[model samples]
Target: MAIPPDIKDSIAKVKPLSQSAVRLMSIMADPDHTVAQIAAVVESDPILTGNVLRVVNSPAFGLRAKISTVARAVSYTGGNMVVGLALHLCASGIFNNPLDGYESQRGSLWRHCLFTAIASREIARFSDGKADPEVAYTAGLLHDIGKAVMSAPLGDSARKIIAIADKGEMPDFVAGEAKAVGTDHPEVGEAIAIHWSLPGPLREVIRHHHAPSKAKEEYRTLVYAVHLGDFIAMMSGTGTGADTMLYLLDHDYRNFVDISAAELEKVILDAGQEYQQVVESMFGSEEEMQ
Candidate 1:
């Protein structure tokens, strides 16, 4: 479905990512780029560098040695996570705001996205090299960004969409959202990805995260990783809004990610803990999120 002209205009006019954030994404897209190169770009931006260090030092990693340099932090945190952190820092305004349309309070979406990122990374580890864990981490981090853009436009229709999904009148919330709004969050997310000139895999993951089966053949594994990561986040109670667990799960994900129930449980438990530490380091305490 074509995004409505109004939403298209909003996307075109949406806040541009910081130059540092854009640079980090560019470096991430380059397979030949070394971690030091990304570290250099990150160190160029003091805020990004400081945030990376903070996340590394957070209880999430439990590193005994304090990471003083951006390079060490980047190496420890993984390049994908540093890129995700840069994106999160640049998009703070969009993420911090409450999604009234989705009935989500402030900070909930950020937590959900962070949880999904960590979970997606863990899921990718079982992909047998079909998916890159770091790339999956970045894709999962950005999978729901379109929701921030779509929230206001969704407005009161959020309830109607939820009702339809709850009653099984629609296949899932994406269908319900498309029925109520001109487009769903994934579609809007693709538009935002285009606006930001994000790489193809990231854009594909964002656009088809709800239906990994529909993504391009090359990106299906990565998209499925994020799709399952989103499911894990929602199941673990880190959902962004009223539509939590309302999306249909594509069971075919097993074809791509070979994880057992026990592994999935472990991923959820570990990701939930990491998500809390990242949130506390970047935003504030868990109590503040509520």
Candidate 2:
């Protein structure tokens, strides 16, 4: 299926992640990067700096001593959390807006992404350290970004795509999208990731999350981690729209992640609780989220 040219243009027009945010992500992806290095990037952007302090000091962390410096916040919260704050501050427009093609309300996609991030982090814990939980969290946060690009182009056909999935005519909503619209969110997400110059792991995870088995061998574990995370988000009622649980699960995830049924349930519950706190910290208040 060929992606429409207009969608290509839309992908190009999508705002690039801030320079500081990009730098932070790059630094965070390297496990050996120091806290001071990450803090230096966050401190370079005042908005990111304030958000780091705010998130670290938020009730989510329950730190009695207020974090007064970016260095301290980075040290306390870790590079993944600091990078997430930077991305949230810079990409709120992309995250907060409604995906009309999906018939999702404003802010629902962001909530879904946030929930997936937490779930992905938890799920990666079961990966025997083959996959980095921190990277999994960031990948989950941005996994469906292609949906934002595909949304408008898909338009009213989204209903048709949903129908295709519901009637079992397609294997999943992504397949429905391909049959109905000639492309799917994950494909579009790959374009956006490339457009944004996102890290290789992120680009691959965003692209292959729905079909983890199709990912390259080295990346399959991380992709499967995010795939499960995305599923848990939708199952927990934080899906972006009608396509929520319509996607097929790659049961082979057990081979990659080693999460037992009971452990999966615990992850869902714990991640759900963490998601609420993270959302509040990132967005300030429920009112602001809307």
**lDDT per residue as tens, model 2, 1-290:** 56788788888899989999889777767767788898888878888888788788887688888889888888887777776777777887788888888999998878888889889989999999888887898899899998887888778887887777677777888887887677899999999999998988999999999999999888889999999999999999999987888889989999999888999999999988877776677666656776
TM-score to true structure, per model: 0.92, 0.94
lDDT of 1 at 24: 78
**lDDT by residue for model 1 over 1-290, one digit each (tens)?**
99999889888877889998878777766657898899899888988888888888887577898989888888888777777678777887777789998999998888888889899999999999888887888888889989998998888887888777678778888888888887999999999999988889999999999989999999999999999999999999989989898888999999999999999889989998878766676556777654
lDDT of 2: 0.85
Q: Local distance difference test, per candidate?
A: 0.86, 0.85
- Candidate 1's error at 119, in angstroms? 0.5
In model 1, which range of ten residues has the least summed lDDT?
281-290
